[model samples]
Target: MNRREFVRWSGLGMMSLLLSGCGILGTSAGAAGEEVQKNSVSGGNKMKIVVINSSPHARDESTSIYLSDRFSAGAVSAGHQVFTFDGANEETHPCRGCDICHMNGPCVFSDAIENKLMPELLSADMIVLVTPLYYYGMSAQLKTVIDRFYSRTGMLHGKKSMLIATAYDSADWTMTALSEHYATLVRYMDWVDVGQVLGIGCGSRSLVEKSSFGEQAYNIGANL
Candidate 1:
């Protein structure tokens, strides 16, 4: 079926937010001192976006954080509200796949999601995951959060989402695995896929700062 038909059959409430391209939703103002815009699809358009920076590296070195900052700034510039959580600073433990969360609710670990992340997520119109590559795959830090997401019991369904990833090399390969992981959730949650920002060919912090890719990231934010 076509996209619209698929959305209609999904049984999700009237596609609340854009639900793609970073998966931010709702009608909220951007960051302070920013302008809001009318939605092209609907007359009313304000986005409440929550950003999760899942990079294991420091926020300064996190390409995911850096790129997301650009997008967040862009959202603000366009009059959208953005909230962010850095997994690096969060104290979540790894998922044991014990299926306890599946039986219960939320994860058993102590981390930002249980405290800060969930509160923001429940109120957010959209959700964005910013992560780095580890061995050509998602960082373990981000994966831990994803595992915890199952505890939501389909709460994330129909929510908007975006994934931003940075890798030193062969990053494209990681996208398949990442997409597969998200696809499973999207199928059950009725979430939509927006766009992704992939930054490849940069490893060191210095390289990222001086690289044009950084400027591209900034532009991405400026336009978001």
Candidate 2:
């Protein structure tokens, strides 16, 4: 059975607004405006999808972007809404391990995750995390935002989710930590696991451009 054994489908910046594909981009228009990311694709059914891109590299050199672009392109083509955020570029700080949020209020800080992503994430039907594997785990940038999920964490439950990760090493264990972390998140949050596209051995941008990883990403998006 394929990861897409079932079908259903599903950014960041000023939430680089809009999912563009099949000629009908919703036009979130990268308010912060960086280019080369076209994850939108051709399909049907409308879902509000949020993409968190956590690669700190330049768009041209980031293998993670190479895969995320194709995945989202297929999604946009399939008629879902996409909001993308570059967590790495945004001014988001690490969690303070505070429990004020547990007191039924918002977080202590008004940083990027709070100011920008929280609303979109709260209402989003699905969430797609795009990142480059870092030290056997997810990028610290992405983790900081997730840790802030301490605030209103329960509101994020019961949504669909996916992960797209790129790594240079092709070892059998290359993605284990990240994969397990993602698995633990969905299980704990009661989220539906849409699927994951782990681009193993995808080190350089040039290599990723020619790899089937991009195609796999596109297929996942198209199906969703």
Candidate 3:
């Protein structure tokens, strides 16, 4: 099917599953027919994961990128299909406050969301947002994508989500505001908040590489 058709059908399928009381969005079955705990990756079922890497650096020079890579590695090791999107590089347009999406179907804009993100998002079992802290908040690039999500309101409920935030400051409050915003988003979307990994005191790429945050991120991915 074409991308748009795929997205439409996927949304419909998700709604059907939800109404029928199936637990595909979060639960899985263990080998012995036991129920796998939510957010646990022990079962052999392969999850569809979408990683939104919002760091501006193209290389592994940023802590956010480094940690996200580690998470992706762990998820891959557990046999999950992971798709990473470079938010900084995507040509995403800001939402124009028009309610065209509500009147029609998804967003009316012919941008990355229509051509790319929406399809993957509709089909993803989990979403990982990786961002470098900017002014005690998420990057504008990532925020733009979040704003565009308005087009798919009521279509993304129950999806699991995780967050990874990196910052140079070592203070306890380094990412407090951003974490609050992330929590608000999770609540608004009615998605599960799997976890959040904070990589603090990462002044340089080498420091992040040497920090325990990488291992923590990897664990989160593996346990997803």
> After superposition, which runs of candidate 1 have C-alpha atoms over 4 Å from their true positions?
1-44, 96-107, 170-174, 210-212, 215-224
- Cα lDDT of model 3 by residue, 1-224, tens digit: 23354245444443433332222223121212235424253344778999988888865587898988988987787678898888888778888877677623477688876678878988898888889999999999898888777777566666878899899999999989998888766665666667788888986898899898888888666655
Name the candidate that leads on TM-score: 3
* TM-score of each prediction: 0.72, 0.79, 0.81
Off by over 4 Å in 3: 1-44
In candidate 2, stretches whose alpha carbon ends up further than 4 angstroms from where it belongs are 1-44
Candidate 2, poorest ten consecutive residues by summed lDDT: 6-15
lDDT per model vs. reference: 0.62, 0.73, 0.74
What TM-score, to 2 decimals, does candidate 2 have?
A: 0.79
Better of 2 and 3 by TM-score: 3
Candidates 1 and 2, the one with greater TM-score: 2
Write down the TM-score for model 3.
0.81
Residue 129 lDDT, candidate 3, scale 0-100: 88
Q: What digit string (tens of lDDT, one per residue) describes model 2 on residues 1-224?
A: 11131111111111111211122233332211112224322223478899999999987889998888887897787667889988899889887866666623487888888889998999898888888999989998889878777676667766778888999999999999999888767665666666778888889988788888887777666666
Alpha-carbon lDDT of model 3: 0.74
RMSD values for the candidates in order, in angstroms, are 6.8, 11.1, 7.2
